[model samples]
Target: MNKKQKKMLIRILISAALLIGFNFLPFGGPLRFILYLIPYLVIGYDILIKAFKGIKNRQPFDESLLMAVATIGAIAIAIYSEVADHENGDYVEAIAVMLFYQIGEWFQSYAVGKSRRNISDLMDIRPDYANIEIGGKLEQIDPDEVEIGSVIIVQPGEKVPIDGIVIEGESTLNTSALTGESLPRDAQEGDEIISGCINMTGVLKIRTTKEFGESTVSKILDLVENASSRKSKSEDFITKFARVYTPAVVYSAIALAVLPPIVRMFVMGIPAEWGIWIYRALTFLVISCPCALVISIPLSFFAGIGGASNAGVLVKGSNYLETLSQTKCVVFDKTGTLTQGVFEVNEVHHNEMDRDDLLEYAALAESASSHPISKSLQRAYGKQIDRSRVTDIQEISGNGVMAKVDGIDVAAGNSKLMDRLGVKWIDCHRAGTIIHMAVDGRYAGHIVISDIEKPHAKEAIQLLKKAGVEKTVMLTGDSGKAAEHVAADLGIDEVHAELLPADKVSQVEALMKRNTGKGKLAFVGDGINDAPVLSRADIGIAMGAMGSDAAIEAADIVLMDDDPIKISKAIRISRKCLRIVYENIWFAIGIKLICLVLGAVGIANMWLAIFADVGVMIIAVLNAIRALFVKNL
Candidate 1:
């Protein structure tokens, strides 16, 4: 507990003891009242002072004001009835009410602290120091002082201090803190590693690529720290509701206290019995505090955002979290979002020469270019090219490449290039790009290359369907044949093929219009071209690991590990948070309304009013804390 909570807890203990002892004393009248006043002042003097301050400041209808008035009025009534009627009255209930309210306040503070700790634990990624290799020796310095392009040595069991490429050494990094995946990832020389991953085994020599402030860890921290500033509609509604609700109930309590007594005396010709009616009104004021609904609703969203961070999903704010739960349509970019965007040579067909010779000619012809298909051919050849044997290279845009290999004119392109060469080529029946070739004016075989779907792409679509997504669409720049093949493999609902970047945005906008009512549409992408469509969607989720900076900046949610499955997880977290928010709202308002009526009618006492205010608040706070535990979900 904090120091203030500790002090309040001690005061509550002392007041409870005094209240119990004074209640059992044989003393009566003034002596009994003096003893009770000691405990009341000890437990509730701060509340009375705050109430007075609120009144002096022109904002008098807060919970403190209600608490102060309710307890003080009850005490005054007790003293008057005891002295005039020689009847015993209870002041113990007044002290007990204040004591229990303080207890509830302390519980709330503790729960908020616990929820903050969960988020702070995930933010332990900030490295204290970076070890730079200076003068052939490692020197520890502030991470901010470490300049880009400097080589930093990361030892085993240390955080990678900055984003960089591994120039030397190898290690298994534990990226669970960054990616929420428990598996250790193997990193070797030439592989790019981001900051915040712990080097689990072997020392690594990393050449820094980014400054400390621009690192992934820094960006994530900034995102989470500012998350609470953007409040959801639910939070805003509660704020406005409390503003109107608090004063409305206070005036109603006043009318209940004054109007009925006047009607009894004047209109009905009966005795007012002011003491009984006034006591009931005091109980009514105590029961009408809006503490539970005001406190628990925001706490629920904060905990939900923290829980999502723990699972490697960064929600920009509570408003996006609220919107995610209502997503009924999910649009995906085909490459790098649903498919592994890497190209590989799938097969070699229609070979007039040896298959090895066909691959060699293709690799050599495309060696001067750096397209994905070119890289795939070079990778499949698995050997360094003899550039001396090749000369007179030419690149045909939208077709392919042509070069003179071994002083022979060789052309390696698609059907268009072959048509220009007047060489008869066979169209391979396949689901990938078919590169037809001609060697020395004769038809050569074709090599097929294709982009493969991710291993979990099908499962991700299935889970989204199971999670209540009504439409799952894909937009891609690939040909109709290739796009449909991958979409069918992944069970995508619809496919918009051969689209440009602008066309992708149009497709997303059209899909968004199709979603009516409260249903929202979400777009997930990982390329730089996807930024526009991402910004146009209701929820833009980016693959942080391999995504472009523009796409990440435009997205509302980020999956740190580039996993499609976390999309469903993010939605689930948002749904759970909204569920808890609605529950607290309805539950708190329902109980308070019922008890307020009972208290005004004299069917409920001050003790029951305390339960309605503090007890319900404590229960709702505990329910809000449940949003922090999302390990299973």
Candidate 2:
């Protein structure tokens, strides 16, 4: 407990003891009234001061004002009855209301503390110091002070401290804090590693590639810390509702106290018992306090964001979380989003020469090119290319390569290149990129290569369907056959193939229009070219692990591990959070409405009004805390 809570607890204990002891005394008249007043002020002095401050600040329509008005009116009635009616008034109920209000307030404070601690525990990856070798010895300095390209030493069990490339040594790194993956990743020389990963075994010498401010860990920490400032539509509506609702209830309470009494005495010619009516008005005020609605609504969103962060899903704000919960259509880019984006040889069909000889010629002819297909051919050849064996090499844009390998005319390219050489090449009905090869004006066969799908790609699509996503679509720049093959394998509902970036934007817009009555559309992509389409969608989700910087910046949410399955988990978290929010809203408002009506009709008293206010608040707050447990998702 905080110091204020501790002090409030002490005051509640002392006031409760005094209220109990004074009930046994036989004192009467002003002496007993004075004795009860002491305990009343002890329990409610801070409330009175806050009420006065609110009025002085010209903003008095909050819960503090309602509580002060009700308790003070009750006290006035008790003291007046003791002096005028010659009967000792009930003062214990008034003090007990204040005591319980403080109790509810303490619980809310502790609950908020716990919610913040959950987020902080997951974000405990910021390193305190970076060990850099200034001379022959290592010196520990602040991570922010280290410059890019500086060498840093990471000992066993220490964080990587910055985003860098490993130049020496090898180790196993625990990346759970960053990726939410439980397994440790192996690191070796020439490998790139990000910050926030723990060096588990061996020492590593790293060359820093990014400044501290631009590192992955810094960006993630900044994102989580500022998430709460961006309020969702639900939170905004509650704020506006409270602003108008509080003042309206205050005026209604005043009318209940004065207007009915005046109507009874003048129009109906009946005795207006002001004390009885005033007591009922005070109960109405207590019942109408909007504490439960105001506190629980924002807390639910806060805990949801924290829980998602723990799962390696970074939601930029509550507004995005709200949008994610309503996603019925999810559009994904083919390469780097669903597929592995790495090309490899799928097969070598109908090779006239040996497979290795055909691949060696293709690899030699395409050795100078940097395209992905060329790299894939070289990787498949699995041998060093003898550059001296090739001569008169020429690359045709949009076609393929033509070269003389060991004084033999070698043509390795598409069917267009074979047609240009007057060689008839057989078409292979394979669902991949085919490289047609010709030797000395003779057709030699074709080699097929393709990008492999991710391990969880099929499972992610199925899980999304199970989680209530209605439609799944894929957009790609590959050929129609290749896209259709992948879409069929993954059970995608729709496929748009051979599309440029602008074409993708148009397709996404068309998809958005088709789903007009449904929930929002979300686009997931991982390339610089996809940034425009990502930003144009209702929600942009990026693959953070190997995604481009532009795509990450344009996206509203990022999957840290580049795992397609995290998308469904994020949606599940949002739905659970929104469900809890609506539950609290209906529960609090329904109870308050019923209690308000009863208080106005004199059916409810001050003790029941206290329960209607503080007791309901505690329950709603506990329900809001349920948004924090999403590990099973």
List runs of model 2 lying over 4 Å from the truth: 28-39, 348-374, 381-427, 435-447, 544-548
How good is model 2 by TM-score? 0.89
Please report, in order, the local distance difference test score of every candidate based on alpha carbons: 0.87, 0.88
lDDT of 2 by residue, 1-633 (tens): 678768878887888889899999887777887898888889888889999999999999898899899888888898888878888887777777787887788789889988898788986789889998876899999999999999999999899899999999999999888777788889999999888999999999999999888888888888888888999999999999999999999999999999888999999999988888899999998888899999999999999988888888888899999999999999999887898888999999755588888888889999888877899999999998889998999998656899999999998887778888899989878898788899877888899989999999999999999999999999987767788999999999999986768899999999999998899999998846688898999999987553235655788888887689999999999999999999999999999999999999999998889989999999999999999899997
Could you tell me which residue pairs clash in candidate 1? none
Candidate with maximal TM-score: 2
Give the distance in Å from residue 42's predicted Cα in candidate 1 to where it truly belongs: 3.5
Q: How far in Å is the alpha carbon of 82 misplaced in model 2?
A: 1.5
* Cα-based lDDT at residue 471, candidate 1: 89
**Per-candidate clashes, comma-separated:** 0, 0
Clash pairs, candidate 2, are none
Error of 2 at 29 (Å): 4.3
* Model 1 regions lying over 4 Å from their true place: 28-34, 87-89, 133-137, 348-374, 377-428, 434-447, 544-548
RMSD values, in order shown: 3.9, 3.8
